[model samples]
Target: MKTKKLVMIPGPTPVVRSIQEQMGRETAAFGDPDFVRDFTSLLDDLKSLWKTTGEVFVVAGTGTLGMEMAVANSLRAGDRALVVSHGYFGDRFSELCSRRGIEVDVLASEWGRIVPLEQIERALASKNYQAITVTHVDTSTGVCAPVAEIGQLLRRFPDTLYIVDGVCATAAEPEYVDDMGIDILLTGSQKAFGVPPGLAILWAGPKALARRASLGTIPDYYIDFDKWLPIMHEPAKYFATPAVNLVWALKEAVRLIKEEGLENRYARHRRTARAMQAALEALGFRVLAEADHRAVTLSNLIYPSGADDAAFRRLLAEEGVMVAGGLAAYAGRMFRLGHMGNIDAHDLVATLAAIERAAVRSGIPVELGAGLAVLQRELVRAAG
Candidate 1:
């Protein structure tokens, strides 16, 4: 059983040893002074990472819970929500809202394309929504939404809370809470945060908090922001016992991110995505995303003509590399390769070689060394 394969999927990216060491520490009580201090610092660092002074919730849940929290806290049943969707996850937001008895209007585009700003404005003009949600980058399609532009458009609608699902984008993508006029930004730790999955982090700005306040007595209990507010302000007081180890791991992850500098890290992610996408192209695969809208955190590459999706992936796994299969309608037709979170040039080179080998073994036509040649050149250009 050969098991040292590279984990190249979009989430739970390779956790560096330092973060693992933090997670491996002895468990501490929620009220322990040391744990409280660490939790408090983690909250502050989260605010720093998102570039906002808003209140953030770090709870034991997945990104879905974060979405539920954002919805349950900010808007009520019968309220209207505008869901701007790029792909699968965007549609998930629509489902979340509709299940809450909220009237949902979805502005969706083709998998690889983003909804034009004019269409979003037209939708806004036609209806009055209490909350509008956008997926920063829909992993299913590898499409990055125009969040900053959407934020700018949202300025005109001050009453609508702007909620961004950063499950696949946070830490790797640009998500400025205050500057982007975002009311709630939710994400999971597994994706770009470079930590094992467990934490669901959500940032609530003043507007979001005020909205929650206005809804005196919400329906939910576990996912409500009201219950977590006091705990966030004073970690010593506990509403629920925190995920102590994952919190520590997240703190260390944030520390590494800070040390590398956000701008540098973001640039590195861009370079990684670029090199992978270029290599895949040289190997005769087409990127699922449009050129301008491709996600920097990951790439969804369409299989070349006559390529066998399962065989290639299986062979790639045998070659000590793993990648994600496409979601929803594109299943069996595309593969999603993650490039974010603690991955480096060597990992990229190994994955590239494995990809080419797997494709060749799967009986897919390819020029030998063609993909690696382009990948090496890109790496050198990035280095120099």
Candidate 2:
């Protein structure tokens, strides 16, 4: 039997060997002066990456932790919020609002569809919402929302804080958040950051900070911005026992990103996504998202009629390639291909080839060379 290498499914995307080795170093005490310095530097790097002049908060928790913190600190009981829902994460935000006793007016779009800017404008015009929540990219359906347009609409409601979930959007596509005027942007390390799960980074603009200050009682002790901000600003004191190893890996990842420059990193992601989409379409699989709204990181492709989706995934795994099944409403109907995080044309070609083999093994007759040929054409176009 041949040894199998792991292909990332959705996220906790493949961490590079250099970063992994850094994470394995001997642990340092939380109070060590050097650790505090490194932690502070990481926070600075995070702000630079997000391209925000706001205070960046790093917490030892998952992406949802940042969402919860943003919600708790920004909204008091009886506060009204407008949540734009198009997929799983959007619905999750609505649920979070309900849990926190915040009154919510939800504007929902069909799955795999972008929320209309007109609807968002109407929602803002109709109510005095304290905040508005929108997911920059929906990981479930591979749909990228028009965040900039939404931001423009929010200008009508200038006092309403705009919160964006950039978990799948961050390093994959940074301009959408910063250029769009998102007031609060949050993301986790496991997705585009190429690191293990366990840290969440939140960027809060001045408005978000002001809202936090206005709320007299701290929303939650663990995630209170007031408590964490002073410590983050002080060079000598650290907030929580920082995740030393993960912080080391994050710093290296940010270093690589800075070295590559943001525009080039975004271009790489767009190129890889275009190649994958071209190949899959050539293979007779329909793309779940409309061309204009498709995300740069992952592409959701519908299974061919009469094909068994689960068996197709099993066959691919047997061939040493791993892809993910759809979630919730899309389950058994679609499979997602992730092309983010250090993936390039060569890696995409390999995955497409594996898919070709898997299709044949699953008894679906596929024309040889079609997928790869389409992929090559796109790659050539990208290079030009």
| Index of the highest-lDDT prediction | 1
Worst 10 residues of 1 by lDDT: 45-54
For residue 259, model 1's alpha carbon misses the true position, in angstroms, by 0.5
* TM-scores of all candidate predictions against the true structure: 0.98, 0.96
Please give the lDDT score for candidate 2.
0.83
Provide backbone clash counts, one per model: 0, 0
Instruction: Count backbone overlaps in model 1.
Output: 0
Cα lDDT of model 2 by residue, 323-380, tens digit:
8899998899888887777665666777888889888888767887889999888888
Which candidate achieves the best TM-score against the true structure? 1
For model 2, the superposed segments whose C-alpha errors exceed 4 Å read 176-179
- Alpha carbon lDDT of residue 60, candidate 1? 94
Candidate 1, residue 152: Cα displacement in angstroms equals 0.4
Task: List ranges where model 1 is wrong by over 4 Å.
Answer: 1-3
lDDT of each: 0.91, 0.83
Residue 70 CA displacement from its true place in model 1, Å: 0.8
